[model samples]
Target: MKRLKIKSFLGTAVLAFLIASCTDILNEEPRSVYEPGFFETEEGVRGGLTSMYAHLRYIYGNAYFYNTTQTGTDEATYAQSADQNFLVMDISGRGDITPETSRADVLWGNSFNNINTANGIIENGETVGISDALIAEARFFRAFDYFMLVQTFGGVPLDLGAGELAFNDNPVRVSSRNTVPEVYTQAIFPDLLQAVNDLPDNPRITGGVTKTVARLYLAKAYLTFGWWLQNPNNIPTYPETSRSDPDGNDAQWYFQQAYDVATTAIDNPGPFALQDTYYDVNWAPNDRNSEILLYADHTETSEYYNDSSLTYANGGGADNFAVWMMTWNYTVLRSSSSNTEWLGDIESVRREAVQPLGRPWIRMSPTIGAITNTFDDKTNDSRYDGTFTTVYRSNIDVEPAISGPVYNANGMEVAGGDPILTFLDEEPATPIDYSLPPEQGANVGAGVLPGRPDFVIGPNDISRRVYPGLWKLGVYRTDSGNGLGQPNAASTRPFNIAKFSELYFIAAEAAVKGATGSRSARELINVIRARAGMWRWDNSENEERIEDNSAEMVAATPSIIDIDYILEERSREYFGEGYRWYDLIRTQKWEEVAGSYEIAGDNYGDHTPQTVTRSIQPYHYLRPIPQGQLDALDMSAAEKDTYQNPGY
Candidate 1:
């Protein structure tokens, strides 16, 4: 019943001892050592369960890990300020993604730690008379982590140090991996099945594991494993094994199971349902809504609970700063106090801790395909308006501490709350002049539309240095009394991990892969498209906009639905949310979908779009094992080479 609460008691868990606190240098070593006796008590089991939820922070909201998931795909590419950390992941000529640079290490390290903690709870909690329902949460998380690991890095180890799926008290230097089939049949599928059978229909605590949540993961795992078995593209898997399932089921069988489980969850959603409109779903004030099945939680209430200061965050590890990457330096936008000649430039749009504006790192930018192609229906669909910050208004009241009218586009007088800049939804009939120099009042290289009061850039003119910021994932805080508040602070809003809408997607995708269901794939996708067409508020215009274009949206669906259509819908629904790479990988359409992209150069007025090709090799499907993992191994170089995935 609590609003956006991750039970406060999770902070008390002895995670340091359970994870065997390691130095930053050797953090990848899976040498977790929890005292077997601690988890033998009810309190200890509860603490371990809480720690499993807490572990999500290490990966979900991490910006670098975020890059690994998004940059190479069609949804996003490296921006102007991107460094080796981000550029390498783009795979568009910056460099190869080496083991040392791959941020998949975040998942590799944190998931193992959480998996071991889950192992301790599962092994010892039964001795203390812990309830099966309580222990099922551990099983859910253990399976959840293995699912993520297998998707990112093929054939990950199920046995950390002890026997297969057993708790290890002592650290071990050597390790071995389970094949994809073993990981699914032995670890992911079995654990999730138990979790679905035992977890409560409703969460015992806020954001706790539930039957619906377990079913979602179980369904997703089945779907992913089916894709692996099909191997339609013949993508190689390391520590190689035949595609034959241990349970003797074919890919189509697994696909059918996935569809059945997903549709079952969709039918019996417990305390979870889709938000009425797409705007309400990602609205900062409306976070932690029913649509979110799981999230990595942060709070504005206390720094101790937030894991970083709510007042300020330097965009480091464990902070929910992933939103900062796609944010451009909108604060650089300027206006003048004069109509004709250039008077002193005034900061019109200052940074604020609001949904549209946040700390700008400019490390990643959405690909042009994301803006113009994926979200082509800007008028009929509310999703395009809901997803991007296309308009910037003057905020003299918040920053610059000024009081007077300023002149923006066409030397028009503007007050606070007036539009300063706007990314035009589509190319205009009137030309946007990019020839004007910055000193001549064309600040930040933004072109001015004749007779308009706001600087405007058409879709084609969106450069690497200037583009629409991701509005859905932007920062929001209640404490910014009158000024900018804590614009630099990590967002207190929970980083959503799973959503109820995904059940529809999972089921739809499974159905496309040869699973017949009561509902057709088109019907399932239309459910989401209809919701996306409903608009309660306009993000760009910043005003109340009550409109229901659901009929038009549904009518616009193709006569037949396929994988490509499903993927396009996914991008529109979940852009810039770290879902692109995996979605493409699951369908084996990464290379075909994201083989090349187009974006302009990274200067203020540079708007010449150039196509850049990506070198997406088959081995790129699986990320290399992190260098830290290889260094921690007490094995020979040849053995380590054999241990690592090929083409690293």
Candidate 2:
């Protein structure tokens, strides 16, 4: 594959803005500096492909849809910053949301932009007699884009082939609102099948799409479709709703299709396998591990592509948005000259003031009966470690409180020396300067308590709150590290993920559902449990180590697994990854999980609580198609209803 320098596209919003002086100074005539004919050469193709890849970066890059939506929802990553406050509101059922707020818009736009670029390459390439492999690559990319679109918004406006100037001026938008099966039949399945047939087994060297990547995408599509088709949870229209469709066969058929594709992909393992070590699997720079069948290649040089920056404090004032909000109360502290402590001492003190370093916003609420009941046995499982970070209190030796106070129920300043917890052991015994000159003895700040003695500190400590006096540990560094560089700074916190563990659970589910040919359901589940470093069901030799095998031996094991173990395992595995909210909805246990609270917290009194009640109406399952989109479409009532997902 040929590498090219990253260049801004002429028509892109960023580029256009950069070039434009002002709206009043806009030129009427089009600039013809370069022709499409010039872009037909090998270098041109390489540059075009590079541009295409850059667009893909926008989909997966920082502030992109993948980070915003996937991380925002219950797929991966937790929102740690206040900017991601929307996630808490959504998960906790405390706020109203419109489609406009969703990353769906950016995802839809970017995916289609990629598709259009791919289409341009495919269409124009034939005239120049470009390689069949390149054409196949384009087709593969187009198919992948369509797959993403279909999954998010069912039956999107399918734009196939090309268009003329007249047609482009007034594009006749197709209104089939194709069934889930139809989309698979027409767009995804066929395109992938064709691409797999034509594309090379390995195209990494060729700078193009590969059969292996195609297979992974196809398998993932099938798996997602199968779950959607077979599992009633995928259907937007529930039986309790008026918009229920009695199409039962569609679900089963999709599931079967999914199984077939996934099985094929699994059986024909190319370069994909699970990594042995967790750190090597996830944290490594090159995600080009044997396991990553499909992934966007990232490089340090690539603009906005670095993942390492996400974990550390950037010198810039901008906070590490994700880690700051999600990791509970974490902060940074600077040592003053008066307190000439080591770096270790500074970090130690900072660590103490914070409660749990990680946030519990995306946690599986104990209210979810299935999750709560199963994970109740937290001692034996290694999953619990991933779910919760144990907070250890520091052994900071301070003298016991000396106090004198008395107060009535009514507000009154009673006689008292509110217990003073002395931070320092004693004052310097042999003071060098018992009475220092006025010029040398400057007041820096008070001690750890109020009305305490001030000491001489450096100029840096004077401006910034370095001394113990102004230290509000909880409030301090609540934001990610701002532009200013400081020690023990707060940026993004690396939190727990349920990636590999969940895969094991998925494999178990597939086995239990009779999808795995060789392994029995119990055996598959046992393998998963063992992989997670948990106790095996069959290790009955010792009472201290063995798990009760009675549950594993049942005929209704899969159902029981779904009802009890699986949910709990999910909770334990994916506590802060944001899966809890959706899992509750899928299991039809939202009420049990979040019924006690009101929909909105009352702000009537002085101290207004932010607590809100959970409400899962039928319409809540699928968000309404944006009101703007609905208003724009000049459609008949019947057509509108047909196009909209059942609830919306």
How many pairs of residues collide in each model? 0, 13
Question: Looking at model 2, which ten-residue stretch has the lowest summed lDDT?
Answer: 17-26
RMSD of each: 4.4, 13.9
Q: Determine the backbone clash count of candidate 1.
A: 0
Task: Please provide TM-scores, in order, for all candidate models, with all chains considered together.
Answer: 0.95, 0.57
Clashing pairs for predicted structure model 1, backbone only: none
Please state the error at residue 595 of candidate 1 in Å: 0.6
lDDT tens digits, residue span 1-648, model 2: 223443333321111111111010111222222123434554444444444544543443223242333232222222222233244334444344455554445455455445554555665666666777766777777778777666556555444223310001122323334454555556677778777777776544422456656765665565555555444444453222222123444434443444455445555555455554322333223244554444333332322322224334332212222222233222221222222222211111123212223221221111222122433444344343323322221112211211222211111111211111111212333322223222222211212222322222211111111111211001122222322122234222222211323434444444434454554445545544444443332111112343432333343234435433555555555443334544544444444544443111111111111233444454554444544444445678776666666544
How much is the lDDT of residue 356 in candidate 2? 27
lDDT of every predicted structure (CA atoms): 0.85, 0.38
Put down candidate 1 lDDT per residue, 199-278, tens digits, no spaces: 99898877788999999999989898899899999998877889889889999999999999999999999999999999
Candidate 2 regions exceeding 4 Å error are: 5-53, 61-93, 124-136, 160-179, 198-213, 230-234, 237-250, 285-287, 302-325, 332-516, 534-560, 563-613, 624-648
- Please give the TM-score that candidate 2 achieves against the real structure: 0.57
